[model samples]
Target: MSTLYTETHIGSMQLKNRFIRSATWENMATEDGHMTEKLYAIYKELAQGEVGLIITGYANIVAEEKPNAGMMGMYDDSFIEEYKQLTELVHRNGAQIAMQLAYGGTKTTYNVGERVIFAPSEVCERGTKTLGKAMTIAEIDYIVQAFAKASLRAKQSGFDGVEIHGAHSYLINQFLSPYYNQRDDQYGGSLENRLRFLVEIYTETRKLVGDDYPILVKLTACDFFEGGLTFAETRVICKKLAAIGVDAIIISGNIHGKANDMIGESFEGHTIQPQGYFHQYGDVISREVNIPVITVGGLTDIDAIETIAANTNIQYFALSRPLLSEPDLVKRWQNGDRAQALCETCSKCRTKRGNFCIVNKQRKATIAGF
Candidate 1:
C-alpha cells in the first residue's frame, strides 16, 4: 500500500528507507580482488545520497574457484581490516551494507593455479562447452565451511549483513535447479535434496553470524531454462528457507546461452542480453514469499522504477545500472531533484572487471532531466 521509500525492516537490520543499491559486479577493485579508492568513493556517494541499504558486489569466499579473476574475494582474514575501511565509509554516509559472499560454481574462468571446479553434483552447468569436477561429498563439506567461515569474517569486518550469492545460476543455483545437477546422492535427486547446499550454507551461516546479525540470499525467480528453479519452485523454496532461518531473499534470474548454460553468455537468445529487464520475475517471487525481497535486472527508469514500487508487492527497489549512473540518485530524488537518463545499457559497467565507471560519472550530472 505504501511507496518504496517508506522505511522497512529486513530481518533485524533497520533500513533508513526501502531503496536498495543492488549487488552489481562493479569491476572496481584490485586484481588480487580487494575494494580500492574508487570503489569506496562510488559507494560512499550512494550512502550519502540516502540509499536505504547497499548490497555490495560479489566478494568471493575463495580464490581458485573464482569465476573470473575480477571477482572481489574475502578469502583470507588478512583482508578484513582493509574491508573495514570501506564499510566505515558507507556507514558514515548513512546507509547499512551487506557483503555478497560468492563462489563460482562451474563458471570460474580463473585457473591461475588450480584445476578443480566442483559443483554439488557435476552435470557440468547445463549448456556449457566445458566440464568441471563433480564435488565429492567431502569436498562439498569443505565448500560449506568456506561459506560459513567467510560469513564469520564478514561479521568481524563490521558489515551489517552477509548475503549468500545463490542466484544467477551460481554454485547454489546449479544445485537448486535439477537441470544442472545430476546425482543420486542425498545432495541431489528431489527438490528438497537439490536445495541441500543452500540449506547447509544458511544453517551454518546462521551459526557463524548469530541471530542478531542479518543473513540473506539472492536466488533466481526462474532459471528460464527447462526444469530450472522456476517461480513456482521458488515459492516452495522460500517456505523451506523460512524454516532454515533465512532473513531476506533477493529475487534474481540468470541469462543462459542458447541452451541453459550457467556460466557463459549465449550469442543469442533470452539470457538478459538486453539491459534493464528483470522485475517481472522478482514480482512473481515477492508475491509467493512472505519475507522481505529485493529485485534487479537492467532497472533504470523513474516511471519503470515507480511501476515496480506502485503496482508491485515487494519491499525494496534495487538497481545496478542506476547507481553506477549516479550514486546520489536517491538523495536528489528525496529532495525533489532527480532526473531520468538511459543507463546507456552499455553494460560496460559489468564488463571492465575492475575499473571505475567508464560510462558514467558521479555527482556531476544534475538530477533534472528525466
Candidate 2:
C-alpha cells in the first residue's frame, strides 16, 4: 500500500491520506474578504480531487492586516457563516479543511493603502524602504486578542482546526526573526522573549478552542538570509510550540527577497528540481519535538515522497504549486501512475494575474487549437 494514501491524524482531526493541500493564495475571495463562488469551486474541486486536508489561504485576522486584494477573512463573527458553507462543502466531498490565520505586519499593507504597519521594532523592512513603526504594548495586546478571536471564529465556522501562519515574514514571523525584531522589551531581545508572541497566541487560542481542537503552526526552519532566523533558533521554537500543545508543525523557509528561492524555479519534466529540499531541516526539528512535522517545498515525485516518508519522521507532505496544476495528483499517484507532477513551476500562480496554473491553461489552449 502507498504510504501517501494511508490515514493519519493531526491531533483529533483524522485525515484520509497524508497529502495536504498547503495554503495557497487563491485570489478568489471578494474585496471584502468574503468567499465567492469561485473560491467555493476551488475548494470543492480539491476535496473531490481527493486532497487529504485542505488548508485555506491565509485569512486576515484584522482589517488593517489585509495584505492583498481577494484574500480571505476571519476577523469577525460575520465571516463564520460564510466559511461554514465552505467547510461543509469540503466535508461533503470527503476532506478535512483548516483555515490559516495571519497578519501581514511590515511585509504587506498594499491593499489597505498607506497605513502605519505593525512590527516588533521601528525599522525599514527588508527588500523595501518602507519603515515599520514599533507597536505599543496596547497594540500588541490587541493583535494577540485578534488571533484568539480569529481562532474562535474558525472553530465556529466548522473548520477542523486553525493553522497559524507564522512563516513567510508575516506578523508572527517578524517578531520571531531577529532580523526584524530589535526591541529590548518583553516581546523581544532574548530567544524566549522573541517567541513570547506566538506562545501567547497559542495559549489564548487553546483556551478558547479547548483541548481537543488541533492547532497547527506553519514555521520557517531557516530564513536563508543574513541576520535572519537560523535553523538552531527555529529548532528551539518548534520544540517550544510542540510543548505548548501545537498539534503539528509545517516546516518552510526563506523570507522577503528570498521567498522566490523557497518556491524554486521551473525545471525539465520529471527532473524533480531540488526534491525534498527542506526535509533535512524538518528532520532536525522533528527529532527535537514530539509533534508531527509536515514538510513542504519542491516535492513533486512519488518515489522521493515515499523515500522521505520511509526515512524520516515527517508525517505529512504539503503541496502548493503542484496542486494548482493537478488537483488530482495524489489520487493519480495512488492509482499507480507514479509519474512526477507535470507542473513546471512557472509561478504564474504567484503573479498578480491570479493564482492558476499557466501550464495547464496553455496546454488546454494548444489542444483546442489542434
Candidate 3:
C-alpha cells in the first residue's frame, strides 16, 4: 500500500518518499573531473525541498571516453573524497544519494578536438563516423573490471548506492543495440551475448559491493531508435538482472537526440521526470521479475501523479523538471498551492557551456515552505 509520499526502501538506503532526482547532466563539475561547489549547491537545494533520493548526472567510469562530456567522473581514486563531500551535503539536508555510472560507447566525445570511440562492435556510421575498431574480448573484460572498480569507489565515497547506466545509447546500451554492437567473439551475435556485458558488469559489481549495498540499474525497455534494442530484449535483461539480485530497475527510454523517437522530453528530465511514463515497459518487465520497477519521463503534473499512485502495479515515481524549477515542489504542491514551478522544457540545462537558471521571471514565485 505504498503511495508517493510513503517511506520506502531499495536495499540499504531508506527513502523519505518515493521520488528521486534522476541523473541530469549539468556541466557543473570541476574541469579536472571532480564535483564542484556548483554541483553541491544543486543537490543541497534538491534536498532542502522534498526529493527523497538524488541520482547524480552520469558519472564517467572510463576517463578516456570523457563519459559525461566534462560533467563528472568517478573512475579516479581521488574522486571519492569530493563525492563524500557531496553525500555529506545532501544528507545534511536529508536526501539519499546514488551515483549513476556511465561509459560512452560509440558516442565518444571530444572536449575540444577529436577523440577515439570504443564499442562492443563497429558496424555503422557513428561516433567519428570512421567505423570504430570492434573491441576484442580482452578489452571487454577490462571494461567490466573498470565498472566494478568504480562501483567500489562510489560506495567508498559515501553514496547510498550505485546505478549502472545501461540505457540511452551509452556504452552498455551500445552493446544491447544491434545497430552498433556487431561483434562475433562470444561478446556479440546473440541476445545472451549482447547482454553479457551488463550481466558481467552486474556480476563483478555485486562481487565488489555484495548484497549489503544497494545496486540499481538505469535501463531502457526499448531504445526507441532505428535498429536499437527492442522491448523484447529489454524484458529479458530486466528478468536477468532481477534473478541476479538487483535491488531496483530505473527504466528510461531512447536518446534525447532523436526527439521524435523519445517517449517524452524535458531539459532537466534526468531525475525528476514522472514515474511510469514508460509504465508499459515497467509493466512488461515488472510482470517478468520481482524487483521494484520505477519509470521516468515528462511527468510534470501533480494530479497525474495521484492517478499513477492509485495503481497497485507501480512501485514509485521520479519527478525531474519540477524539482529543478523548484526544489520544494512536493511540499508546496501537496499543501494546496495551485501555482506550481514551471519548467519550460527549454533544453537550457543540456547546453555544454552550463545549465541556465530559467526560474526567475517565470514560475510565479511561490514561497518554498522550508
Best-fitting candidate, scored by TM-score? 2
**Alpha-carbon runs more than 4 Å astray in model 2:** 109-113, 255-273, 362-370
Residue 30, model 3: Cα distance from true site in angstroms: 1.6
lDDT of 1 by residue, 137-245 (tens): 8888888999999999999998999999888767888888888888799988888898888898888888878988899888876787666666677778987886667
Distance (Å) between predicted and true CA of 270, model 1?
14
Mind giving the per-residue lDDT tens digits that candidate 2 earns over 310-341?
98888899999898888878888878788999
lDDT of 3 at 204: 96
TM-score per candidate, chains pooled:
0.87, 0.92, 0.88
Query: Which regions of candidate 1 fall more than 4 Å away from where they truly are?
Result: 112-114, 126-128, 256-276, 353-370
By lDDT, the better pick of 2 and 3 is: 2
| Local accuracy by lDDT, each model | 0.73, 0.83, 0.74
| TM accuracy, model 2 | 0.92
Worst 10 residues of 3 by lDDT: 266-275
Model 1 worst lDDT window (10 residues): 266-275
